[model samples]
Structure formats: C-alpha cells, structure tokens
Target: MGRKLWLTTSAAVLLWTGAAQAQDAATAQTDQQDEATTLGEVVVTAERRTSNLQETAVAATVLSGESLDDRGVFSLEQLQFVAPSTTVQNYGQGNFFNVRGIGKSEATTAIGVGVTTYRDGVPVFPGYFQTEPYYDIGGVELLRGPQGTFAGTNATGGAVFITSRNPDFTGVNGYVMGQAGNYDNLKFQGAINLPISDTFAARFAFNSEQRSSFHDITGPYSGAPGDIDMNSVRASFLWMPTDALRVLLKVDYNSLDFGGYPADPALATNDPFEITANGPHSGKDETARVSLNVSYVLDNGITLRSITGYQDGISVFSTDLDGTSALNNTFYDRVEEEVWSQEFNIVSPDNQRLTWLVGAFWQQDKVTFPVTTFPEGAYHVGFPEGVLDYYIFGETPKETKAVFGQISYDISDRLQIQLGARWSESTSRNENVYTTYPAFGLTLLQNDEVTAEKTTGKLSLNYKVDDNNFLYGFVATGFKMGGLNAPNFYVPASSFGPEDVVDYEIGWKSTMFGGRVRTQVGAYYMTYEGFQVIVGDPAVPLFSSIVNVADETVLMGLEASAQARINDWTVDVGAALSKSELGEFYAADPRIARSGTCNAETGPASPNCLNLDGNTQGYAPEFTFNIGVQYDVHLPNGATLSPRMDYAHIAESWTSIFNNEALGDRLEARNLVNLLLSYKTDNWTLAGYVHNATDQTYIAAINAGLRYAGPPRQFGVNLTRTF
Candidate 1:
C-alpha cells in the first residue's frame, strides 16, 4: 500500500508539472548540465568505455560532486537515502552495504564480500577499508544487479565505483571548504593543483574532521562512544610526454580515531543517544594506497591501458557486547589487510560500427585477524568468571585472475547489441591458528586450500524509439567465491560453497519537454543459487559461521526516477519496490535454539529445526523512495539564495533470515527530512543544513544479538571558496 501511494503521488507530480516549464527562469542545475542549452548528457565508464548514461543499458545512479555537496552526503552510509534499492547499515564494529536485497551480514573476516567497492578503479577490501569520508571526489556511480563481466569477483550484488579528481595540466586551480555545526562538529577540506611545466601537473587534497559524540556514556566506563577524529590526504600526478602516451600516479592515506563504539544501550531504553559500557571501547583505522595508470593510443585508433595498484590497511576495535553498564561481555578485534592488483586493457575506437574491449586482470590479497573475548559468569557457567582471551591469527592469501572481453555492434541507426563475457579463477590458502591466553592446551589449527572458477557474461539489446526515448533489455550473471570458516566456530560445517545469480532486466529512458524533464524506469528479476547465509551459533552465541542453502532464492524489483525543472523550482523523485523470498530451507533460530537439546528425531527441539521457506532476505526493504525540491531566489546584490528540502521513506525490514518479530530483528519503517539553505556568489558560498529534521529514531543494525540505533537530528553550517 505504501509503495503504491508513493508511486501514485510521484507520477501525479511529474505529470502535472511536466507541461509547464521555462528555459532559464527556474533551472535544474546539475553537474553534467551546460546551463546554456538543455541538460547535458551524462557520460559514464561503467562498460570500460565512456558512453552516454541514457544510452547505457545498465541500471546505475550517478552522483556527481555537486550533487553530493548539495545533498550534504559526507559518509558512504548516508548514500542509501538518496539511491533506490540500497541500504547501508552499521553496528558497533563494521558496516554492511547492500543493493537489491543482496549482501553479507556477519562478523567474520575469512569469507568474501557479496558487494564490491572500488575507489579510483582499485578494489577496496572489506571492513574498515571500505568506510571512508567522502571528500574531493569527482563522482560516485552505484551499479545495481549482476556486474560480473566488468567488476570481477565478489560482485554478485553489484558494485560501487568512486572516482577522485585527477591532476590537470590546465593552469593552477583549487578550492577550500570549512564546516561547523552542532555537537561540536568541525571539518576542513582543501585541494591545490599546480602545473609544473606544459606536460606535467600535480594535485594534492586533504581532509580533517572532528565531531563530538552524540551518545553520553554512563557506566563503569564514562566517555562518549560516538566521537570521531579522522584525517585523509591524497596526492596525484599527471605526466603527458607525448600526444600518444600519458602517465598518472596517485597516492592516498587515511587515519581515523573513533573515541568508542557508536552504539547505544539496546532493549534497555528507547533513547538512542545514550550508552552504558563497562569495558574499554575505542577504534582506530589506518590505510595507505598507491596506484599508477598508464595509457598509450596507437595510430590505428586502438588504445592500450595498464593499471597497477597496491593498498595496505589495519583496524583495531574494542566493544562491550552486553550493551549494559555491567561488565558481563566485551570483545576486541584487530585486522590487517593488504592487496595488490594489475590490469591491462585494449580498446578500439568508439566511432566505428564495431566497438570492442579486451582486458586481463590479476589481484592478490592477504589478511590477518585477531580477537579476544571477556564474558562474566552471569551469561554462562561453562568456566570460571575469568577473562578468556583468545586470538585468531591467520594469513589468508588469495590470487584471482580473469580475462574478459566486450563488444558492441550497431546493427542499424536505431538498434544496437552488446555481448560480454568473463572467465575468472581464484586460489586461496588459509593458514590459521586459534590460541588462548593461558595456553592451557586450548588451541585449534587449520591449513586449508581452495580453488574456484566461473564463467559470467551479459547480453543486451537496445532500441531507440526516437532521439529522446530509448528502451533496453539484458540478461547478466554474477558469482562470488566461497571460503572456509574459522575453526573456533564449528569444524563439521567449516566451509561454504560459492553463490551465483542470474538477472533479467528491462528499462526505459526518456527526456521529455525539450530536456526539461528526464526519467528512467527499470524492472529486474533475479534467481539465486547457493545463497550464502551467515549466522550465529545457537549453542555458542559468540561464534559465527556461513551456510549455503540448498534451495534457490528469488528476487524481483522495480526502480524509477525522474528530474524536472519547473520555473523557479527543481524537483527530483525516486522510488523502489522489491520482493524477495527464500526457497524451502531448514535453519535454526539463534533466539529460540537454546538449551543445547538436539537429537535425530527431535532436531533442535528447543528452537525446532524449522523450514524457512518464503522468508524474506535480511535488510531487504519492500518500499523505498525519496523526493527533493530546490528553489532558487535571485537577489538584488547579484547573488543567489537557494532553499532545498529532501524527504526519504523506508519500509520495515527484517534484520535476520528467521523473520520472527518476537526476536526484535525487524526494524520499523522510518521517515526522514533534511533542509538546506545556501547563499552563493561567484567566488564564495555559505550554507546551513539541518539533518534528520524530524528527529526520528530507527534501528540501523542488529549485531551481537542486539540492536544499534541510527543518528538523531543535527544541524551544520559550511563555507566554501574557489580560486
């Protein structure tokens, strides 16, 4: 019902305002627009070649730098509110990002991720490395559905591509921005570009942000748990020795110090801005990455490109698992990860009847993780109420290699066909050991090797109805590699199989009323096999493992978005509706599978090994939509004053596959509003924004058998200058 209402309302608004429009009176200014003419064409490299977004068959959302700033999106998690069929959730330790009801939700480091994230064309490892402040970015592209042909492994759900500004050889230019707001929030960001000769240039960017904690800790440990202190820097260089050859180098570094876990007491109170922890709680993250890209254009209109990238990062976090003032449970986790990759590509010119690209990619990744737990006697009586410190030290080294090729042929002036395929193989080895602090012979060791391979591809056909209307249909396949679980969890079920998906999609794109209005609608249906599920052990609450269901799962969804320029007001609206159901499968509910009672005839009697058929996937909301309007008011002082308001709604979603409301894993629906007012001139600008204007409280994650709340209402002010 809610989804229907949102769709109806959005359609009505667009239809009513579609006919009334003036060229320059109230213009919808976007980053890709020229302002002098109609809306400029948006170009994207999602297919390894620059192409008009309206002509691309892939379902993607492109958020330019200007759009991000106007929306005041500072973190990756906040992006979900603006994009359809996306969700980003965080608990005390890590973040989980999902698109179209597909993602991983667990506290393990051995398994691969379902969704892959790339920064400047380099894949970002999971955990802390994936969460970073968004500053000085060129644009962000969120691709939905199967993207295996272009994104390589671990892209079953989709991929996120973030591009940073590159060094330019066109004179000196830069910008600086400063922000201050409630809760003692402060931020500073700046960039400088310098041309060191006609062929060489360098650009440097930096960001520093500090914010006070919104949660007040009151317990044995009395300190704020939500404070943030982070700094990041990037340096890029461009060298063009000749017209045919170009070289680019980029280096990035980030450091973060979170005062404590950003979680409040769950099930104890309704307040989302208070925490009670008795154990030491803090988190630190550090990363350094470097990449070199070289491109050479041949005289035959063929281009050769090579990308070399290396990254290393570390994360240390401690949290109180009990979410109470009593020191009953605490745990600490540390992770060190490093990755190296090299890719080579050959591309033909785009002007010919046949455009093609061939690429080869190779990547190596290694990681180590350690954990310690402290549980008081109140929870369990298996042992004395003493600190049971355990460590998980493992070196999971993996090598992945892939060869992919894509070709697009224009059969006629109004019809085109594209076909792509990728063959990928991966080999991994896990040398792991689990040991206790006392060394009382409580140790576990494992040496495992695994190899997997898959062939994925996409086929699409596009038809142009006219110069301003287009239709497309495609079928794509995606796969994610499987891995072994830690021995500390369970030995019998130590490994899980790979997961795969097949997606069928159809979409339409249109630019109506002389480019004053742009709209897109896409519908997708996906079939999943060997769906990997991560869950906690019923007998041992602290242990987690992954399982692959025997039956197949199905998911279907529709997404629509529209942008309009109506005289003095610019309006943007988007909506998504999705329905997912699991096939018949047997699973144990952690909340009910207690007492440790099990037998062949009475399997897991306490919880009762039950069928999870027809259950919805975790965190897959059925309805989501957002609407925003910006009105520009011309001033007599030759400046502009703009006021914008944005609203987003998310329907209730399950946090666990069990789908039992009695366990409190289902989060209720929430509605949020944000407002921004800005005064702009030629050289400088000032802005004030209020986030979560309604001050709604909602659950963001259900981790460690407890719920974590999202942020509350907050306001901020920003000033930016350009030179």
Candidate 2:
C-alpha cells in the first residue's frame, strides 16, 4: 500500500509539471509578470538575532501566516502534519511533542520538558500548556535539534516559536470570518486595529467556536455529545516613543471546554468513531498571559531589548478511566500553574564583520497538581462494594537563571563561523501527599529538593557557495534539568539528574532554475545521555514513574524539502527518514525482570535486568513525508480561483517504550489527504475544505491502555471580509 501511494503521488507530480509547462509556453509574457511573486524570503530569530532562514546554520522549518491559513492550522496537533520531522501525540491529558526522534510522551505535571514552546520570545510552562490555539499569528518557527545556548531550559529536543501580528500605527484595518461545517460546527473570528494617536496603536482579536462531538457513545450511563467549545482573545498596544525606540504590551486569554477523550477501550474490536464509555466526562482549560517588550537602538547602531512576561493557567478534567458503563473506575485531575520571567538582550549591528548577541534570563514557575479517583459497582470483581476514594496532591516550585552569548565572525565574504555558550542553574522543590477519603487521613508524604547546573554551547561554520546556494555544518549541545518524582506507593527513587544531548549536522540550502525551485537537504546525528522515560514501577503494577534510563542512545536522520512555483501552480514536498537505537538497559519494572535476582522491595535488582536494547523510540517513525499542490486561475471578472490538495503519511511506529506486543503497542502506517477550494475578490474570500477526505481509519494515540481514533472525514465552508 505504501509503495502504491508513493507511485501515485509521483505520477500526480509529473502530470502537474507537464500541464504547467504547456500553460507556461502559451502565457510566457504573463508568467514573467508573476515571476516576482515567488515564495517570500523567510526571516527567523532562532539564535536571538534576525537572519534569513537560508543563511542560518541551524535546522529549522518556517510556516508563514499564509501557509498556516491555507492548511487550516489552529493548534499544534495540526502542525504535526505540516512538518515531516515533528510529531505531536495526544495522551488524553494533553499533547506530547517530539522533534527528530527526541521527546517524551507522558503527561506528567512536575517533570522537565524536552521541547520548549515560546510565544513572542517568552517561554511558557510545562508541555501541556503548549496546546493553546493559534490565531492572528504572523508565523510559526520550529527549530530542530538542540537549542541550549539561548533557550537555556528544557531544550534537549528543540523549540517552537510563535509570533503574533503586531499593531499597525499607519491606519485602521481588520478582518472578520465566519465558518460552518459538518457535525454542527460553527466558528467566528475577528480582529481590528485602532490608531490611538500619532505614535501609539492598538489591535484586538478574538475567536469563538463550538462543535458537536464526533463520537457515538453507548454505555450504561448517559451518553455525551463530545462537543468542543473554545473562546480566545488577544489585545496588543504598540508605542513608538521615538524613531529608535519602541514599546509593546500584549495580553491574551483563552478558555476551552470539551467532551473527554474520543477513545475506545480496545482497537481490535471497536468501531473507529464509536465509544462505549460511562459516567460524566469532560474537561476545561483556562489561560491568561501578559507580556511587555521594549526595544531601543543604541547610538553605535546596536539594539537592546528587554521582555517581561507573566502567565497563569489552570486545567481540570474528569473522565471514566475504564471506558465502561460500569462504575469501576473514574478520575478527576487538575493542574494550576503560574510563571514569571524576564530576559535582556544586546544585539550587534547586522552585516558587520563581527556580529554578536548576549542575553540573560530568569524565570520562576510554581504548579499545584492533584488527582482523585473513585471506585464503585462490580467493577472490582469480587471486591467490597463500599470502596473509599483515593487522592494524590503535589506541589512543585522551580527557579532558573542563565546567561548566554553568541558571536559570528565573517571570514572573507563566503565563509562564516559562529560560536555560542550558555551557563544555567536551576532549583526544584516538590512535595507529594496521598490519602484516602472517608477517613480523610494521609497515607504517605514525601518531600525533595534538587539543584542542578550545566554549561552548554554551539559551534557552526557556514559557507556561501553563491547568491542562491549555501552549505553549513554545526555541532550543538542541549540540556534538560531533572527533578523529584511524586511519592506514590512503592516508589523508592526521589530524584534524577539532568538529561543531555549533543547534535552534529551538515546541510545545503539552494534556489535553482531562476528562483522557480527551492530545496533544502540535511543530515544529522545525535547522541543522548540519560534519556528520560516513563514506565510502570517495578514494585507496583499500577503506579508509574519517570526515570532516566542509564545508557547511551543514538539517533540519526535525513531531511529534504522543496518548494516550486511552476506556471500557475505551487508545489511543496518534504520527506524525513530517521532511526533510533536505545542501548541495552535494565528495566526498573520487576514484572519484566529476569528470575530470582530481582529485589522485591526496591526492585533495584542484583544484576537481573530486562534489556530493551534494540527497540525504536516511542512515536518515532522511520519514514514520514508530505506533498501539497495548489493552482490559481484568473476569472474574467478579475477575481481568482484556487484549488489545492495535500497528502501526508506517517510510517509504522511503536507507541510504548517497551514495544510490548502483548499489550498491542504497535501502530500501523496511515495516509491522509485534504482538499481545499476557494474564490477570492478584492475584499472578500469564500472557501470550502474537506479534511481527511478519504475517511482514513487510524489510531491517533495509545495511552493508559486505550486507543484514540483520528477524526473522520468532514467538510466545511468559510467566508471572510476585509475592511
């Protein structure tokens, strides 16, 4: 099936090329007039300095505002399909992200993150909060590989940077959109810019959407609509005090309410869009953030910037864990987090022989997490009917401080060498307490404090072959500070050390055929130490623990992407191939340990261990790729028509670290295709789209012994007006 799909896609590309060539010859003059409208130059700030993406040495992907709208991407979940080397998996509680085969999938509250997500230059808390919706944005940049020099914290994998549209002081402008789709979906969005004075401007944007559930529930308890309700707003104020100075203040808020997991108990016998869960199930998430940014140009042609940000968020959910009508198991979990951060940076003038940037960052994060479980009915099978509720409460406070600097030296005019380093210190204090209801007495209490410090750096050399081509090579190191684990039953370990990785890469970027075709190809190798993984505790079958597997792991991959403007058609193609090797390691789970050498109490085993030597990393597909094409047709009335198609495929991969076949941990490869058709006038746009046009049946995620199916085929229409 995979081979056939690839062949079909290739044939389509050939057909499109032939058609485009024929049209180009007939409209040669017209084509020349449109030649100036190729893919625009992509500018990125991955290294704390603004530079053309093709000129940067780092491996990264940039999605412009137009691309985001064309793909109908509003969340990180949709972004996974747009980038071949990145994967975002939902684990019930929230989404887990991975880039280049390095990341964690568990939804733990107090653990450190591998990939850091930032909004407008400010880092956000823990991984789950990274799921916020994307709207009124300028661009989304995904920096692959390690980004430790400037990112400073929890950047072993990479980073995602989101840029919001800024307020315009020249005039007033805005747009409004209304959308209706299948499944009783309705959405509205609007944004407006107001010029308050000669030097100050304000912009406000908002979105409200609601959709009925796609799953049909059939169980003992009342069924649910599985609806999706979300509202978000953002306000920005920009002040230009002088020609060399500017200040910006922005505040954003979002609220989301949804039916619980759209999942089935077992993948083997359940329908793709049917669930048989019982009891009340739902979830809500609220978030608010305020940020201030000031930038001033020095007399020496340098720039100094300062950013201050504060965020407060809370997420609460209740679900039927067992996914059955029987009241056997249910749970309620809540996470409240607060973060405050400040950063200062000094950037040297661009195009200079010696370009440098220095920065200092400080952040404080506090989180309160708690979970309660209820047991009832014959769900326990022979247990007493009157079972007490169990509760777990935890509080984690963390602080981080760092200083980093990077310098790039131009050797002659064709070769440049860049070097950077960062020193970071972090402290974590955590407390966990467990108790059972009815008695309201504590069963256990645990506390731990940990402090860690690390120094990381980057070195790169880039060579410009010509105006349209460049070759680069670089080596970078990334780090993630580790901390204590929640004190649950039979957990003997209290703390873990930081996880780190070193990455090496070489790549080429080029634009050929007179700017008609642009391509980027790269190869990378990464060596990881102290890989963090979540697994069932050896001493307790039901409890989970996060531990750093004591072994050296290696990952290597190849990435290629191309964009072409052939006549009236635009084509984008990307492919990624990667492999991971987890070194031989002992299993902490006693149940998986070998015979008599395992210790029963601590389960630390005396030489007896279960080796997972040759397993692939969880959710890391060996091969993934995407292809998209869109064509523009001019109408006699001076309007324009566009039709587009996109296809993405994910190769087979394991969802479980252990690759446990007995538990059905393997997921099969799947393919999806989307279609879009739109008509545009000078001030209005009307569009319709079909997502998952083939109604592909695939497992989107597997966690806590359940499988979640991807959304089925659905179609929608949107109308927009610009003022």
Candidate 3:
C-alpha cells in the first residue's frame, strides 16, 4: 500500500514538472493569472525582522488564512497533513506538536516542551491550551529545526508563529462562515471589522462548534466521550497615536470541551475507536489571554517595539484508565496554569547591508493542582486492595530571563553572513506534598528551587547565485531547562539536568519557469545531549518519572518542497526523509522491573538493566509526504468553479522508548486524503469538503497502557458571505 501511494504521488509530481507550460503574452498580462500563481513572493514577518521568505535561510511551511480555510486546516492535528515532518498526537490529558523527531512526547510537566509556539509574538500557550482551534488568522508559519536565537530556550525542535487577523483603518468589513458536517456537527465562525476613528480600528471574531459523540459507549459510562464542544472569542484594537507610533491590543478567550478521548483495550479489539469503559469522562479546557504590542519608528528608520502578554488556563480531565471496564481503574485530574511575559526589541531598518536586531525577554508562570477537590495530571490503578498516590497537591513556579540578538552583514552583492546568540537563565521552584494510597505514605517538598543557565548561538551564510536562486547553510544550538519532579512515596525526590542540542543544515531555494515554479530543499543533522524522557519509575512501577539519557543521540533528515502554477492549476508537493538513533543507555524496564531486580527502590542503577542503545525515538516517523492539487475554471454565468484534492502519509513509528512491538507499542503507517469543491462569486462562496476521505483507522497515541484512535472521516459543506 505504501509503495503504491508513493508511486502515485511521484507520477503526479512528474506530470507538473515534466509538462511545465508557458503562457502567451496576452494570457500572462492578466492580474488574475498572476495572483493564481501559488509560488508568489511572501513576506515572513514572524522572524526577528520582516524579510522575503524566498531569500531567508529558514525552512518554513507557511499558509495564508484563505488557504487554511479552503483546506479545512483549523487545528494542529489537521495541520500535519499539509506540513511535512510535523506530528501531533493526542494523549487524552494533552497533545503535543513534534517536528523532525523532536518536541514533547511525554505527558508530564517536569520538563519544558522542546518546541516554542508563539501567538502573535508571545510564547504563551502549550500543552492543553494548544488544542484550541484556529480562526480569523492572518497566517501560520511552521519553522523546522532549532531556532535558538529566534525563539530562545526550549526551541530545540522548532517554532510555530500564528498571527491573527488585524484590523485596518478602512471601512467596516468582515466575513461570515457556517458549516454542517457528518456526526451531527455544526459550526459557525465569523469576524467583524470596525473603523472607530481615523486613528483607531477594531476587529472582533468568534467561533462556536459542536459535534455528536463518535464513540459508541456500550459500557457503564457516566458521561459522553469523544465529542466536541468548542467556543472562542477574540477582540483586537489597533491604535495609531501618530504616524510614527502604533499600539495594538488583543484579547482572546476559549471554552473548549472535548467530551474526552475514551480508549478500548486496543490489544483485544479490532476497532480502536469503539470502547467499553465506565467512568466519569470529561476533557475540558478554559483559557484566556491578553497581548499588548506597542511600536515606534524613529527618524533614522529604526524601530522600537514592546510586547506584553498574559495568559490563564485551566484544564479538567477524568477517564477510564485500564479501558476495559475494569473494577478499579479510573483517573481524575485538574490543573491550572498562569503566565505573564514581556519583551522589548530594537530593529534596524531593512534593505541595508548591515542589519541588526536586539531583544530582551522575561516570563513568569505558575502551575497548580487543586488537590482537595480535583484530581489532575496523574494516573493510578487499583486491584480492590489499594491505589498508588491517591492525593498529589502541588505548585510549580518558574521564571525565565533572556537577551538575544542577530546581525547580518553583506560581504558582497552575492554573499551575506549572519550571526545570532541568546543568553538565557531560568529558575523553577517546586512546593508540593504527595500522599500515597492504602498505606498513606507522605512525601513533601517546601520551596525547593533549581536553576539552569545556557548560552545558545547560530551562524549562517547566504549566497545569491542569481536573481532566481539562493544558497544558504547554518549551524545552531538550542536549550531546554529541567525541573524537579513531584515527590512520590517509593522513589527518592529527583531532578533532571537541562538538555542541549546542536544542529547543522544546508539548503537551496530556487524559482523557475518564469516564477511559476518555486522549490526548496534542505538537509540537517543534529546531536542531542542529556535528552529528557518520561517513563514509569522503576521504584514505584506505576508512578511516572523524568530521566536524562546522557549519551549523544543523533538525528539526520532531508526535506524537499515545491510549489507550482501552470495555466489554471496550482500544486504543492513536500516530502521528508529522516533517521534517528538513540545513544547507548541502560535502565530497568519499568514494566518488568517490579517483578525482578536487586533494589526495589532504585532507578537506572539497579543490578539488572535493559539495553536501549539503539532504540528509535517515539513518534518519530521515518518518512512523511504531502501532495495538494487544485484547479479553477471560469463559469459562463460570471461565477468561478474550483476543485481540490490533498494526500498525505506518515510512516510507521513507535509509542515507547522500548520499541517493543509485541507489547502493542508500535503505530502503523497511515494515509489520509481530503477532497473539496467550491463555487464562488464576488460576495459569497459555497464549498463541500470531505476530510479524511479514506476513513482509515489508526492509533494516534499510547500512554498509561492505552491507545487512542485518530479522528474519523468527516464530510461537510460550508457557506461564506463577505460584506
């Protein structure tokens, strides 16, 4: 099946490349045709400074707001189909975005996520808050590989920048959209723009959606699961006090309720989506954020900017743990997180040989678990006698300060050199008390603090071979701070050290066929040290722990992407090939250590250990590719007709560090296809779409001895009206 799919995709690519056509002078003169070219120039504003994407050294997959809506890519999970080398896996409590075999794969907060996600200009949301949908956005930029100088610490994997639609000083304008789909789904998303005054403009957007349960709960479940109820509202105001000064403020809120992801005993079931577990099942997330951005341009053409952001998020989850209607197997957890951040920047004017940008950042956040009433962020099982860690009440406070800068100097008309660096310091304090089951053992920690400091840097050179071709290469370093774990009864209180990574890459960008075809290709190699991973503790066997494998892990990959436009056809093809190898390391197998070992209260240093020298990283697919095609046709009645198709595939991956297939830890490769048809006029558009047209059933995640199924096939129609 995989081979056939690859061959089909290759043929499609060859069709466009081999048959590249040239348009007549009269046909090329039309603005409509020029705009239809999918390979048009785009300005990447999310970087340290605004620059043409085709001229930059970064490897990014950018999508406009219109393209996102047309492709029905509303969330990170769906985004993987359009962006190569990206992965999103939902683990019930939270989901994470992984890039190039890096990022967060564990469901714990003991260590920070490797990737940085920026909303507007603030890295305010990760984990559960990341599940929020996207709407009324300007664009999304997914930068692959380490972005140390750009994103600072905790960006070993990559960075994602999401910019929402901003209000313009124009007349009142906006668009409304309504959608209906299978599984009794209904959705409404729209936005309004208001020009309050000559100097001020405002934009308001909202989204409300709901869907029926996809799971057939045959067992004694207390609440519905595998359903969606999402609502969000956002308001943005842009104020220009003077021609040289601007101030923008944005406020956003979300109340998302995912009735919970219930799992069946995947080992005994053919249908991973159908479940028979019984317990109160609910997955609710509430988040609110405020961002204020102020900027001013000086007489010398330099710019000064300040960004301040605040966020508050609360998540509640409860579900069946064993997933087999077990007598005493359920989990209840609740967590609240709050963050405040500020950043200031000084950027020199663009189009200069000596361009530079300097910035400083500071952030503080607190994570709390309401133990008396809410059970959150942990798993425990019972056998009619006792359960491990009945009550865990804790507070984790963290703060970070950093200074970063980048400089670019043109050595000649065809060559440029760039250098960047960031100095970061972070502190984490854990104040918590842990209470065990049946025996009622207690572990307490009062204001224990750990500090981590790192200096990361990047160096690159860009050479312009000609007007339509560019070559670039760079080496960069990334860092992620470690933190103390919550104390458990059987294991000693421990803390992991920070992890570091160094990445090397080279790339080429080119345009051909009179700007109709644009292509980018890159290859990267990364070495990781003191890699952090989450696993069951050998001491308690059921409790989770964070550990660092000090060996030097290696990762290497190659990526290629091309966008083309011919006549009325638009096509995009992207593929990534990668290999990852874990360094030599030995540890007790958590699943079996309880039954054998010298010391029952030791970890990694026990007499008997499992050799995990060459295991593959979890969720790191060996290959991924995406192909999209669309064509437009003019109608006789002054309307336009369009049809689009998208295909994507993810190679097989493992779910655990052990990589044991017999233990049900391997995830099979998956192929997804989507179809869309649309009719458009000047003021309105109507479209029909079938997402996941193949309806392939695949394991999306594995945690706590359970597996989750990805979303099933969804067919829907959408109507949009513009004022």
Residue-level lDDT of model 1, residues 288-380, one tens digit each, is: 999898999999989999989999988767667666765556666677789999989999999998999999999988876534333211111
lDDT (C-alpha) at residue 334 in model 1: 71
TM-score of each: 0.92, 0.91, 0.93
Runs of candidate 1 with Cα error greater than 4 angstroms are 1-37, 222-224, 264-266, 370-389, 435-440, 488-493, 536-544, 594-606
* lDDT score for residue 94 of model 3: 74
Evaluate residue 148 in candidate 2 and report its C-alpha lDDT on the 0 to 100 scale.
88
lDDT (C-alpha, whole model) for all candidates? 0.78, 0.77, 0.81
> Where is model 3 poorest over a 10-residue stretch in terms of lDDT?
595-604
Instruction: Report the CA-based lDDT of candidate 2 relative to the real structure.
Output: 0.77
